[model samples]
Target: MGRVTGKRVVITGGASGMGRATAELFAREGARVAVLDAQAEPGEAVAAAIRDAGGDARFFRADVSVERSVGDAVDGAAEAFGGLDVLVNCAGIIGVDKPTHEVSEAEWDAVFAVDVKGVFFATKASVPHFLTAGGGAIVNFSSIYGLIGNDEFTPYHVAKGAVNMQTKQDAASYGRHGIRVNAVNPSTVLTPLVEGIARDFPGGLPAYEEQMTGHQSLRRLGRPLDVAYAVLFLASDEADWITGVVLPVDGGYTAR
Candidate 1:
């Protein structure tokens, strides 16, 4: 049997990127999944793909950063799967990039709203179910930028940093309740988020990978699945005692 056999999972930002990849992988390992995203078209497509592959899946259209939408998304998942066991907070935005001083207030707020507040909403909505079920896993998608600061991502960096701290605090509060909370801090991956950043750079992917890989001890760019595998392990009972930790899936990028 697959590691996640018969479990029910709720994945935010499940329409694309790392979120989509992880959700699909989780389904492959035997979890029933509910994909939540603001983009209905792609979200439904992903859900359809999973279901077609003989895995149980459903899709919901909702914005994670909004309270009403987030609540609805949780309800949608609960309706689809009966209850939730895994809450993956992957819905996030890169937001406007600039030096801290040049970044607009709106830019900062928008980043936190999606990256930070979204996690709060998902956890708040899922905690009751988790407590009722006697336990569950909450995986927060943080970043290496959160662990280490960088230029051109003032707000994103701070938001991720907050995500890390929030993960820890939530773990502390919910551990006794049987909920395990953890954050995955990944280095630059070959995601659309990085593709967008590559646009501003002259050499594009080559230059992007060069700089990103150079920082890592492994010196190789990370794939979405790299982070996904980490999430899977943490989402599974394998990581039963790994709460309140910033598990860096950064290809040794943070060792330096």
Candidate 2:
């Protein structure tokens, strides 16, 4: 049951969706979790829930897009846990859905600020701590769009591609020191945000689900836990020999 026993983990965007699921799962598997997010209330609630369930957890408020915020938050969590063992960069946005030509500079910058720069900031801040510990693990949340292109969310796809490269580069940079860095590319997961969108779709939730699942070989949208399990594997010792890999948890969406 203790897949990550005694590990200390810091998860960005732990307040909701896949990030929330990863936090909870890590805690359940015996990791002391730090839930870092801009959403104070929900982040606190997530921490409280974990504590209520007899898990070690705390909430740290931080804007991932800012270097200082990420640095402070990572340090705080490491201090609180006595050291850090893992970092999960899960906070991201779909950004403006316009094509590259129609996108404004500001819009493009905004998406990269969070999706790309946030990953950089968090990883940069965590490296020193990992170096101190002599080793650590990092699981970045990229997307299927990072591996394959679609017409929508061009900025997001590009940012995630950057993340994939970042993952590999850092893995190469740190592997000799025992640090492992990997990324997971998730397809259309049925998170609350997606559910809301489906509800408002022209043909309602059923049609939206069908359309979304049509491209996937599994013919169904993902659940947060599905991706969380992959994160857990990458973060755990079982994957100690695995680094610089971009695993797809997309229900075979890329296969097609």
Candidate 3:
């Protein structure tokens, strides 16, 4: 049987990037997928693609920072899937990249809103349902920047750093209840999000991609599949004994 066969998963930000990759992977593995994303077109497109591939999929529009939206999304997913087995909190935005001193209060708040607060809302909304289902797994998205430092990545790092701690706290508090909480911290993975950042950077796209590749010990930037594989393992029963851990899909970048 497939690793996630008969599992039901909810993935936030499932319209694109790592979230989209995770959703596709789960559906392909015989799981029912409910995608929560703010972008309608892409979100629907993903669901349609999954159905076309003989997988069950659904999409919901939600802004993770808002309590109501997050709550509704979680409730809707549980209603549609009969139960929830896994929750992947992958919704986040890097916000405006700038030096710490130059960062605006609004910008800081915005980054915290989606990157940190969103995870909180989504996971909290699903916790009770997970308990009802007799146990569940949660996969949160962190970043290499959370552990390391970078000149222009202040807000993103702060948000991801928070996610790491939150993951541990959730696992410790809920493990007795059969819930497993963990995090996936990845380095430079090529995605639409990364491509957009590269375009707006000082070195431009090609130069930034090269820089991302250069920073990895493997000399190649991480691919979405790399992170997806790790997440799949963590979300599966194979990781039953694992919880509150942070797995880095960093292409060995953190080792340097």
Cα lDDT tens digits, model 1, 126-173, are 888888789999999999889987776789889999999999999999
Q: Mark the regions of model 2 whose C-alpha exceeds 4 Å error after superposition.
A: none
Error of 1 at 160 (Å): 0.4
Please report how far candidate 3 places residue 193 from its true position, in Å.
0.5
As for candidate 3, its clashing pairs are: none
- Global Cα lDDT for candidate 2: 0.95
Compared with the true structure, the alpha-carbon lDDT of candidate 1 equals 0.90
Model 3 per-residue lDDT tens digits across residues 28-123: 999999999999999999999999999999999999999999999899999999989999999888888788898999999999999999999999
* lDDT, candidates in the order shown: 0.90, 0.95, 0.92
lDDT per residue, candidate 2, 40-71, as tens digits? Answer: 99999999999999999999999999999999
Best by TM-score: 2
lDDT of 3 at 193: 86
The per-prediction CA RMSD against the true structure, in angstroms, equals 1.0, 0.9, 1.2
lDDT-better candidate, 1 vs 2: 2
Candidate 1: regions farther than 4 A off: none
